[model samples]
Target: MHLYERLPIFVFEIEACENLTYITMAIRFNLDRTGRHLSLKDWQALPYAAREALAGYIPGDDDFPARLDQLVSDHLGRSPDTAGDAPDMAWEDTHALPPGLLAQCALADLAPPSVADWAGLTPFRRYVLTKLSRRTDKQNHCFVPAMLEFRLAQATL
Candidate 1:
């Protein structure tokens, strides 16, 4: 079983769900590292569900480091202190855009208006929207609407 399987899961409220009592779930992982050691590449490589599940736990707090340590030791069967080493590729905002989105930006020629609008977005928001845009099946519909909303919001300023 995967390490996540053994962890207790909890349902959390999400505004995206209109009627559902629980729109998201979480599985706490045990690791010594906090958000500082996490990489965007590592996060993107995770399955969508796992990514969402892990999001709640990413923002480490007082007990988080210890919990992470325990998770690594328990799941990976590694030593508690082993997770302190950062991944080879460090996490950065520039690398947050998925490949397809980067291609789309290239194709669209990313007008100054769009670039400016996108630049104004918070890193997290930009990350999410870029990922959404990068998806192969729904890129146009999903990304265009988000872009429009972003543009409209920017126009108000």
Candidate 2:
């Protein structure tokens, strides 16, 4: 059985990154349990805590290949033959950024070496950040907490 389908989280691009002996790849999930798959890039861009509570990877794992395989088999039972890609309609709008959200992003503390990597993210990721950073009186509790969580996750990753 192929590895991705066996895992509860369906990740793509399982490859050894650069010269590193370890493997690295982006993972995707039908995370809401609704069969709606979020892109791996978008998934990683989400707050790490949420990712963990939702579908977090094991941290500081040394034996990743075995760990990943076992986790997949335990979670998903079997790998499927098809690796589905998003429909063409899923591309981002990539329009001009709103100044208000840009100001909010300016305040985020990304990991030091990659500080302010916000603009480097894809348009959809930027849109999600904008939404999370939006000022809201009622949902302020919700978005505010997410912003903090995203920062914390950034540090660990």
Candidate 3:
């Protein structure tokens, strides 16, 4: 799996069962570097502050996955699972629209952002778009809404 697949936190939309209304699920991943999925109880057992830190952290650098493990260790007073090797991923902060993101928009037939328009985005928004584009559906459904939210794309009926 790409390291993005193992992101510690993300926001996704889920259709509400009764009304077919969409709700955002701001979920945190409880998976460890060793590929252990922490049970909900175990995740809840963690100190709230630590959980908050993990949730807000923006992953960067080669040591990031390890740093995330350290976050868990700081609170648990012990190590998180290390029984498996972590996948290598560049966690660098980016300033430009990633090629994959362009491809994603093109494949979906949306207008790709011009360089000036892309540069107007904050790093966090760029990061979210980059991650979202790499996601399931190749981000076909979510990408347009995000672009529209940023005023980078025109809305269609």
**Rank by TM-score (best first):** 3, 1, 2
Better model by TM-score: candidate 2 vs candidate 3: 3
List the candidate 1 regions with Cα displacement exceeding 4 Å: 1-16, 20-98, 104-117, 137-140, 152-157
Model 3's lDDT to the true fold? 0.51
Q: List, residue by residue over 1-157, the lDDT tens digit for candidate 3.
A: 4222443333233222112121111221123223433335544567755554444444333444565567657766666554354422211234455766777788778888887777677655665576466643455666776777778888777
Q: Give the C-alpha lDDT of model 1.
A: 0.39
Ranking by lDDT: 3, 1, 2
Estimate the TM-score for candidate 2: 0.24
- List candidate 3 stretches off by more than 4 Å: 1-50, 56-71, 74-96, 135-137
Q: Candidate 1's residue-wise lDDT over 1-157, tens digit each? A: 4323333332111232222222222221222223333333443444455443444463234565565445444544553333454422211244344456655544544532344454566553454454445444433544544555555223222
Most lDDT-accurate candidate: 3
Count clashing residue pairs per candidate.
Answer: 5, 3, 0
Q: Is candidate 1 or candidate 2 better by lDDT?
A: 1
Predicted model with the maximum TM-score: 3
Worst 10 residues of 1 by lDDT: 19-28
lDDT of 2 by residue, 70-119 (tens): 44444445322233543222113344444434444445432221324544
